[model samples]
Target: MTVQTTPAGTPMPDTMEPEDDDVKIIADIDEPWLPSILTIETGLPTMGVALGAGLLGVSVNSGRGPLVAFMIGLFSAVLVFLAVIDWKTYRLPDAIVLPLYPALGLAVAAGVAVGAITPTAALTAVISMTAVFVILWLIAFFTGGLGFGDVKLGGLLALVCGLESGYAAALGALILPMILGGLVALPLLFAGRRKHEFAFGPYMVAGALLILLLPNVLVPISRGSLFH
Candidate 1:
């Protein structure tokens, strides 16, 4: 049967019109309010994390490259969102990840053009991501530190971090959560826990936030100029 394709929101043709048997009509529809609610509900937490990380980076870096750090944090937030959704729903849809590539690329290019990020710093960022993923992936494989979702998330995180502060920042982000997880899990383990599986997405989010905001948090601890 012959079929006519109609634009979304356009009126459908009358049944009397002739149709080809081989034609297939694809219908487009708008999402209802639930999607908006879900997006807001999901996006708000990620935004909060991003903002917090940005402030932290500004403080630690002495406000040298706050925008670059903020952009990195924002990109990390997308990875965090994907990981969280996958943890909850067991699927990481392309809708959450594809848009981030362009954002990261543009942010990096802009930062470099503006001298907000040095080319050397950008190279370090790449190394930082690579070291973290390779080391973590090996550990996770041998010790089950994480799963495939985390592996993919780590790689995504590397791209963002590589464009910002290099490997140290990424390490800071990755380590923050592990430390937090240990503190939290220690109590449970001591309380006679058995056969437990902790949700890791939250920690990954925390780590990224720590990396983003390290300038603020690290200043007091480091108590001096950044070395190297």
Candidate 2:
């Protein structure tokens, strides 16, 4: 009789726990109380994940100029991680989601400090976050279909999208998610999973990433690009 342990050496109960080979643990930190701990045993290689994320990040904002694109790229990479974990667990841990509040603000601040981003853009980002958060908060309160996690993630996505364009893009980010989520959900509903809960973070991330990558897309639709 042998006991198995995670690659990180966390114990796995043979009777009650998944097999050691079945999961890879991702901890942004090893702290037990942190929400960054993610145990996903999908048989995917670590290097593969990193490679894919890097490609996605680069592709997402490569047109935003070097500095902005680089930072957005890094954040997009993180979004990839969050998207997968949220899909698998149906929960977006606070460890990753919570920090984006400060991290995104700081990134905007850094941009302003260097003159890459204007103060006006920074303010727009803040407004974007607040607006999305408020709207989603109200939706979650009224509909009971959205969770706090979705609300927070939606706001962060708006923050980045706002930075990329303006308040209009941020608003577009919210709409895109709803549209995309509905597209994904309609089929499931027809398939008879009406009460089924699905992960919404991935669509949120996709909307933000698309907003950043395709800055020209919503330009005519947005009417005025404040940050651009």
Candidate 3:
């Protein structure tokens, strides 16, 4: 069996969880509305940034109407920032990620307010987020294919997707990201970098965005715009 090792040739951890820092700071500060923001990369890869911008455009053009579009467009911007940070650092800070749950919760509520999403769909979003978290946590426990950051992000994605579609679609979203990740992994394996750890967050983001934007992509094709 091929053993994966780091640059120093040490066996990779069973779970590729980021090593915790030892010199932890202790403080008594007000638990303000936010957690401490972790250090993130200011410089991002151009391709990833461009893709993010494209996704933002797609979100705006999703044809879900104004209020829904604004919410998702905001989310797309946030995802872009997270995706680039994760792509560079392989870390998604709790300060950034955890806020998204409540934000999406608010989005669902607003969507209901605007009659963009049904009350039943809002309930299903809750169910879908819970189900996605449990399933992702199990996968992390077993295969270590995902990090806690990815798990949280997956739940957020599930909530948004469930609000738009339904429970089954949200659950079905689990597969595409893995398939996408595997496809990316293949090149590294072939290039003899099989042991190299790459970020999984971008793939997860891409998968969710694809599902969310598919109707927009499909409608034009169906109407024979490209074919014509």
Judging by TM-score against the true structure, name the best candidate. 2
User: Tens digit of lDDT per residue, candidate 3, span 2-92?
Assistant: 3355555566444454344322223343332122223333443444564665567456556766666666666666776677668766887
Q: On lDDT, who's better, 1 or 2?
A: 2
Rank order (by lDDT, best first)? 2, 3, 1
Stretch of 10 with least lDDT, candidate 3: 30-39
Candidate 1 is scored at a TM of 0.59
Instruction: Give the C-alpha miss distance for residue 90 in model 1, angstroms.
Output: 6.8
Candidate 2 per-residue lDDT over residues 87-197, each given as its tens digit: 766887888889988987887888888888888877888888888899899999999878898998888887887885565455445877888888999999999998998
TM-score of each: 0.59, 0.72, 0.67
Colliding pairs, model 2: 22-41, 23-41
| lDDT scores in order | 0.59, 0.72, 0.69
Q: Residue-pair clashes per candidate, as listed? A: 12, 2, 0
Q: What stretches of model 3 exceed 4 Å from their correct place? A: 1-62, 167-172, 187-194, 216-228
Root-mean-square deviation (CA) per prediction: 9.2, 8.1, 9.6
